[model samples]
Target: MRDPDLTQIDPSRHLLIAGPTASGKSALALAVARAQGGLVVNADALQVWSCWRVLTARPTTADEAMAPHALYGHVAPGRSYSVGDWLREVQELTGRRLIVVGGTGLYLTALTRGLARIPPTPPDLRAAADARLRQEGGLEGMVRDLDDATRARIDLQNPARVQRAWEVLQATGRGIADWQAETPPPLMAPDDCQRVLITTDRDWLADRIAMRFRAMLDWGALDEVRAMLPVWDPQAQWAKAIGAPELVEHLQGRLTLPEATERAIISSRQYAKSQRIWFRGRMKDWHLWRAGNAGVHPLPES
Candidate 1:
């Protein structure tokens, strides 16, 4: 069989650009949107929070004005947002071309394959699960009870995972695994969508990442975090953003500006590694082209 023609990819329909922090995923998405007149919908986890612009690396107002951007920096800080919810919004979007960009692998997975309809667990149920997680080993217990699929996708290290699983069991009288076993229809059919992974050389990416972190600090990332601290809840999703710990350390005088910048750069490098792994393992079948290749630019990480 002949290979599918790459040029036939519809700009107005579907495209995905995903990689680690400072990988230039957003820049490529914006370029495509500008060229094709499509909408740039955020697929990132942290960028959804309204209070986190600089810390979450959300696009600036000027950048957004350059093209139509959606779902970025719109959610309230303390509330929980889910992949399923985003899937719904994406489905309802009227854009001729939809460019999805983000580093959250789970969100991408949920977009490609519809999420399980397990409802939110109540507060009391969550508290109980938290107690159980604290008393017993967390993931080990969840592993024992949950089906393989749920266990695999669930962030085992997160207490939120345990609470959600326990709540599913209570409300639905089924293991969280069982509920998620019902395979959902994909958001976009395979024939209707095109996916792309922007592969970058590791060394080049690392240097770019270091420079971006310095730029972020110069842009007052610490001050942004300080302004948010009056309302900070470390357990909140926004508060747990990648730059949070480093900024908090700076605020506490545990680290100098130079030290915090170094730490943030290191953390971003590791995060990029995780993004690369996800793209390689889960999105391997998708079309891939290295940034700076014939038709590509040295895209900056979002």
Candidate 2:
């Protein structure tokens, strides 16, 4: 029962395993890499942060030992790593059979169609934007000011996202949307690879999200976030991790550990919904796999 889309991929050079959070992408990708002598690349945003292993559900040390992995937990906390940086890393790893696994649609899109090369915003411009953000109300103001195209793609509720966009505009004297329209270079061509979006039942995924969040907490997600607080701001990319805000509240004595854990679970469920929607709308052409379906190929053939 070959999936119609499976044949379209260059089996030797590319494979993409994507699904909602906690959908076993890491395990599946590891299996594929081990089977085909491929490299498993981290495509998830939070997995790139150095200090968020437990909170972000990053692959464990044992998992890394199972196969070769790249770009996982390599970035310093609080530093922003753009899709462009991801694309460049992928290109540098060229010629290897690669299995990119993650739930971050933006990173996957950058890999497939190429991203706009908006250069880094200067520190002064960023500082000015940060100041303006604090003064002109906040993210709401930035969202209202942003061109519709840019606003549509960015997570408006995230002040960091809003601030970064403003900084780019301040430094380049052009909108981020306009630069994106120019297109940098495709990270990987459509014809060169196969992409799969591993879809799970909504209710099933919701349950998985809840379970995973609780497990992360049990594994000391709070302590990881707490340790990062000295150097990481709540708005910084790492601090804005999936379970971070809720954990921050717990740390501040605002929420009990149980209450914070519950909130984090709820947040993860909501984020999974967002990821599912983003995949449907953005990667419609990708092959689909249900979470529990056994017919879908499992990698690392026995």
Candidate 3:
């Protein structure tokens, strides 16, 4: 019998495949695109940067050759690309059927549930926030002092999010939560698209994460990082990619190869765990598919 989840998805509509990193989401997206003759649009945040292809595990050359891919490695490393920017770019693409795939929850949420139209923070406010962040040495206190509600809602551990909220509060005299209350309509309504969430046993996923990092190292991830070392800026979004910081530490002699590899793997696992938590909290209704099974077998034609 056809899989119940697949049976519910209409091939004619847009398809969204989301999961934690190294969960085989890309392969499944490729297979769906090949079978349905649809465009594969990237939703991963890091995969948009032109640098660090291997480190990001972006689509391989052979995979791109098989199907039309959009938004992969399209941005310069020095630039910061946000979910808003990605949404704007995606809006410009025209396709009858698009297979959107990635592990970025914010991108997926923006596509389906809409995003806040928060204006760009003023430079002075941004500088002030940066100064305070540097002075305070962390955003937890600053965010709490500025907006208690936002501080409670946002991940305090993520300095970027905390600083962003603080900046918004400073620039517009309103909390980020308040701005989010006035969100625009989603590009694609929930009922209009076929959404799938790939999940697997934690042990199985951990193994895949470790294997993928090893393969990335073998495939010249270090070389890619080395090339970008001269221009890498810690504040840039691409620089914050999981492997980038760890590898930079290695290149600077602060960490040995093995140490960097272990650190990157541990970070990847932690990130995957966080993604799983986000999926459970925000995308619980999306159809669930166990890794390996859905990608290897073709769904019965509707």
- lDDT of every model, 2 decimals: 0.75, 0.76, 0.83
Write down the lDDT that model 1 would get: 0.75
In candidate 2 the C-alpha lDDT for residue 247 amounts to 87
Q: Write the per-residue lDDT of candidate 2 for residues 1-302, one digit (tens) a residue.
A: 32223333355768888888877677667656655678888998888888878788777777789898899889996576777788888888877888898999989988887888788977677766767777757667777878778888777887766787777776787778788789866777877888877877778667677777777777887789788767757646666688799888888889998898888888888888888888988899998766554233322110
Name the candidate that leads on lDDT: 3
Candidate 2, superposed: residue stretches over 4 Å from native: 1-10, 147-161, 294-302
True-structure RMSD, every candidate: 4.5, 4.2, 3.9
Number of the top-ranking candidate, with TM-score as the measure: 3
Residue 104 local lDDT, model 3 = 94
How high is each candidate's TM-score?
0.86, 0.87, 0.92
CA lDDT, candidate 3, residue 155: 82
Candidate 1 vs candidate 3: the TM-score winner is 3
Residue 270 of candidate 2: its Cα lDDT?
86
**TM-score between candidate 2 and the true structure:** 0.87
Q: What number of clashing residue pairs does each candidate have, in the order they appear?
A: 7, 0, 0
Instruction: Give lDDT tens digits, candidate 1, residues 1-302.
Output: 12223354476468877777776677777767766778888999888888778776787777799999999987887677777778888888844678888888878877886688887777777666656766757657755776556667666765666667756877777777787778578877666677777677899889888877777777777888898877876766677677788888888889997888888888888888977877778787777766554243332247
Ten residues in sequence with the least summed lDDT for candidate 3: 293-302
